[model samples]
Target: MKINKLLILAALPMIGLTANAQDKGPQKNDFTVAATVSYNNTVMQNAAVGTLPSYNGFQAQSTNWNDKSLQVGIEGGWFFLDEWKLVLGGGMSITKHPGYSGVPGSADSDESFEWGDVPSYGAVADQNFVQFNVYTGVDRYFKTKVDGLYLYAGARVGYAYGRNISFTDDEYNMGKSVGEAFNVRGALTGGVEYYITDGLFVGAQVDPFAYTYNRSLIKPQEGLSNLDANSHNYSILAAPTIKIGFKF
Candidate 1:
């Protein structure tokens, strides 16, 4: 009977310690607000068509690198259940392409074709792209040995608005237009964060896959007709992001 009593006493302290740990665990009511930046370097292929001879009846592909764009955004989330959160975010991005210029019939004519009979004829073409996106997602956190370290996995859906402007210096004035588009995409993500204090943290995240549906309107150039196009794209490998945030 004495040994049984000692065993019971030992178990009581362990039970108390477990209860104390639970009482000190992270709260479900915590709210977090964060800022994020991301870069993607993968090249994407885009299709183009137009009523002009240069564009008519020809199947052509344009290539652009996703990493050439820069993104900045803000996100906010509330933990409604232990280790589970619902988040909403918005961001903007800018992308650019630099084109080459060369003179025709001169020593500088190596890169560009001569237009008409002008000996000094030269051409330079470039594009600027802009985009804005809004998204929402749910994440579940996994606890780590470090008190403030967190790891999570989530899925997100977003709507985006985009525009592209192409500029060219040529006698025929080709490759100038304002193209606008809208798209929706879904992504799967994983992230890790480290809290610098009880209320401040820094993190990083990556999206492995993102599928998009897009619709675009290409404005008429000079005398050309307006072109409307729809496309579906899959980003098998998306972007990785850096994030910082505060919790309350």
Candidate 2:
């Protein structure tokens, strides 16, 4: 009798839980939290490459900062219609762009590269970048399921903030300096998710966007007054990103 009562008491709580779960209907959410990793490639170039007074490639400074990066951000929104989700999200990507110390021309500047593996223009100075991005997008979830899988596609537009590369030559005490630039870009993404539990899901997302910047200051000649400082065009701004995050 004692064992029977204990089992009955234990089962009573589970029964109540099941009943409660059934009574709550479907889950309705107006907000969501997202954390993601983004792989970006930044490229900028002179709009008038060979036609202008500036260096052919000197439209703006370029960095691999948006290269392969990681991002963490949050999103919240309302579900206006059951078949469509209006989602908004923002995030910051922190990355370690490989610094070039040897190769000049395409790799870096000819400012301060003195003692390195490749050659010497000045003292070997490193070049890199870091950035933060804010994004907003809307996705349409398909109303079909094979084994509880939902497909979605959306577009994102936002701003990116980062610091340009700067270095000085110890030989002539000349330092390279560039101003910070905030640029705008857009992304198109699509993904599929399978719910393993009530609030736990796993999925994949991809974004292809462009990253750009302005041309910074570079000392072309060594202490020559009659000579002019030549500005080079930046590289291209285009990258495809793959992402994985969560919803809470």
Name the top lDDT candidate.
1
Candidate 1 contains a number of clashing pairs equal to: 1
Write the residue-wise lDDT of candidate 1 on 1-248 in tens digits. 99999999999999987666444323599999988887522222222212233544422111122624765667899999889999997767788988656465643454554555346544655777787778899998988886678899999887767777776655555656666777677888888988776678899988777776766666546566656666666675567789998888
Candidate 2 per-residue lDDT, tens place, 1-248, comes to 99999999999999987665433211345344444445443322211111113334333344444444554445554455554667665545444333234323332445644455355343453444555656666777764435346777777666556654545444443344433445555556676655444344556655443333333333333353221122222323233333333444
Per-candidate TM-scores read 0.58, 0.48
Report the Cα RMSD per candidate.
8.5, 10.4
Per-prediction backbone clash count: 1, 18
Looking at model 2, how many pairs of residues clash? 18
> In model 2, where is the ten-residue run with the lowest total lDDT?
43-52
